[model samples]
Target: MKNLVYIAFLLTFTFGFSQKKTESLKIQNNENAKVHFSDGPALFFTNSDSLILQVHPQAMLIDSLWMNKLIKSPLYDKEQYMLGDDEILVAGLEELPTDLLKARLKYLNSKTPFKIEYNPQLEQVIRTYLQKRKSSLSTIMERARYFFPMFEEHLAKYNIPMELKYLAVIESALNPNARSRVGATGLWQFMYQTGKYYDLEVSSYIDERSDPYRATEAACMYLESLYKMYGDWSMALAAYNSGPGNVSKAIRRSGGSTNYWNIRKYLPNETAAYVPAFYATLYIFEYAKEHNIKSKERAISYYATDTVQVKRQLTFAQINETLNVDIEVLKFLNPQYKLEIIPYIKNKNYILTLPIKDIGNFVSNERLIYAYADLEDTKVEKPLLELIKLDDKITHKVKRGEYLGKIAAKHGVAESNLKKWNNLKSTKLQVGQKLVVYPKNTNPIVTAKVTPIKEDKDETTYYIVKLGDSLWSIAKKFTNVSVQNIKEWNNIWSVNSLKPGIKLKILNLLNDQKK
Candidate 1:
């Protein structure tokens, strides 16, 4: 009887200790896990082991007891939650379905450098991320191959770490045309002013911020400068995403801890997670094969073209005409030309990228291409000169956000003139719509006097107003009298209307006035 009682007591005490230890382990695991909210999804990280994620509340209980046992194994590394090859020991486990077991094994054997460790606290975060993004590890991997090469090249040129290429993936999924709601544009999402500083020109006809090559070059220069300042790739990437000023301030606030991990707490919430997200993306891309993620089929390949220097201005229309190439094909190859016109100055040259097959054709027709471009320029010049000659009589294309008053002010004509020119009853004008204005005539006035001409006296001429003449319009016609002076001389109350074919007085008019 005494032997039996002692045996029972020993068993109970052992069970209690095991239970207490398991509970303690669970608590420790929860404390180490930190939850992060991202734009697409929430991420959870565990300090004690690899990350464990749940896509929903139901997923929380998904093989929970089995995962708990796996977390305690020696094969799992605490910081990375990576499982060594030999760590598959589980006892007293029920045989799961084949598909379920396969998934579990795949997750466990993932070779990605970044992984979420299994734990209760991380379960909610995982669920949130999965629910919000509806994205899987496979999808992210599939899209990476398309953009990674261009990013790698640019990063290399800047001498930045190849790992930083993942930052572009996070900022924009290699989409060259990505634009943010805040007017941030391009793959790197640079604002207008920032782009200008980096020599990415934005004009009425072209926005270089949308050009992949130029924007990438600008991004590389900016990143290189940031790296020079911080002497750390991670910090440099952080600064690139969220300005150097912010990163500098964050470092200052963190008691001079230049390390991203150390100063992460002081950085903006988005930036704090940005570094980790980049790392996670890198891990996903590098180890995609191990995760059974395959690359998606892309219609276009990046290495199919080579660049050539064009020393003369060339329009896409001209290229199409001379080279017999499609405009879309040209656009695909040379996306940097925003206006579809390479404005190559005398000393400046544009690097025109063309396909390997098309290079010979482009070279063959180079002169014809130049002539075509010159012809186009000449055509543009003629119209402008004609419009100038017509002065206030010509129509103007309404730009975006332009009103009748604004257009009138721009052309140095009254709003009424613009309205009358366009026959517009209202001030509203749609973008690209035309508005007519009689340009200010600048002709020198000649006054006809009935006085007898003395010897050595100059003969004066008087100009008669035509059927369509206003002070502004008349000033524009002559190129002599300014619109202001035209108004002053005529003493017109409102420059809205002027009767044409009226004689105006002028003195000492030269014969070379027509030229």
Candidate 2:
């Protein structure tokens, strides 16, 4: 029954007014295309020459039916959100006076290129956000610290309005992995087609639309194109919500009107409410402090993260286990890896983003890390394609000087696997020892020599364990040292034994060599 009433009201708003063609308002192309509002107690609608509407704050306070209408808007709709998702919706906000709202909006209008005017519908939208979505908004605001700098950088690069950052809040609640019912995805809510149009690749292993930096850059380019098409940010936003074709159709249906408000009712329901939600979000974020919308604690900033080109296919689990990084943090940083696996396809460069502190550790122990990942992959029930490509297997004849570690490094296979495959219990090798190997290089044979690790069991060293230290990390520090070897040598059977200040025995492989 309430939905019927809402529909009736929307229809009345859509078709009640007589058609009057007015010249389309074009925002000038300048650094600051500010739109100043006229001062008065009586607020004027855009089409004031034909109709006059007065602000009735006291009457609005008592109008239950009108308030119900406001509640029905998308701004108050929380049906689509999931818990722990970035979309913030606040409640229990104090009532904002009409005059104050007008003043704030006037200031906003003076600062932005978009037409931010005082209308009952817009007022309802803004008030809904302020009154009902406070906590969520605060959370989103806090979360913005992680992403907004990257957003601003890309927006500035494309000369896009920085306020458009709020569009992501409206679209995906700032969640990069957010996907809509209609299949629009990421922080920018791009559809498969639109994402592809902007060079956001979606493959079996990756979805670039969920990558914050890539998606933001694509969104800026897309929005810049939309603005050029319409010469107005409002319409561009509308077109982005729906499409240019829908906006064009709405324009035609509204007797050739170009104003968003004038043709809004002709647009799709979601698109009709889309721009208002954006504007409301913009207003809320801009005056967050004034309204006491305090931001929650922010996570790691985007600048604190860096990406490195992945040389081998690796799972988030492998990375987490190897690097002692939290799995959730890996997912958050590298959301584009669809299967949580970064693929190493030929000629295609895929990257893994990590907190800046992890980059050096990852790079320094990359070869061993890849070896560990390869060993780990062998245990999976259904291993990734790159792992068990039988076609890439090759044979290598072990020379007199060759050992398991040396051959493994040359072929990019795990040293542990060499022992398993050849049924060798020891590191001893014989001349002309034929070994089956799967080289990552995929060349029929690999002759590239790897600098061998000097094996010296005579010299022993003790390593005091540090906080957050794992066997994998500790093993990476020593040449030719495996976690299995560490366990056997130190008689440490479980990870619990790796308490801080505990000293673990290590063989100083290069003790006799000069630095």
Model 1, 34-58: lDDT tens digits are 2211121112222344222111212
* Consecutive 10-residue window with the lowest summed lDDT within model 1: 21-30
Residue 243 in model 1: lDDT: 86
Worst 10 residues of 2 by lDDT: 35-44
Output the number of the lDDT-best candidate: 2
lDDT of 2 by residue, 388-455 (tens): 34666778998866666567766655554565566664344678989987654332322223234455
The reply for model 2, stretches above 4 Å from the true place, is 1-95, 378-467, 474-515
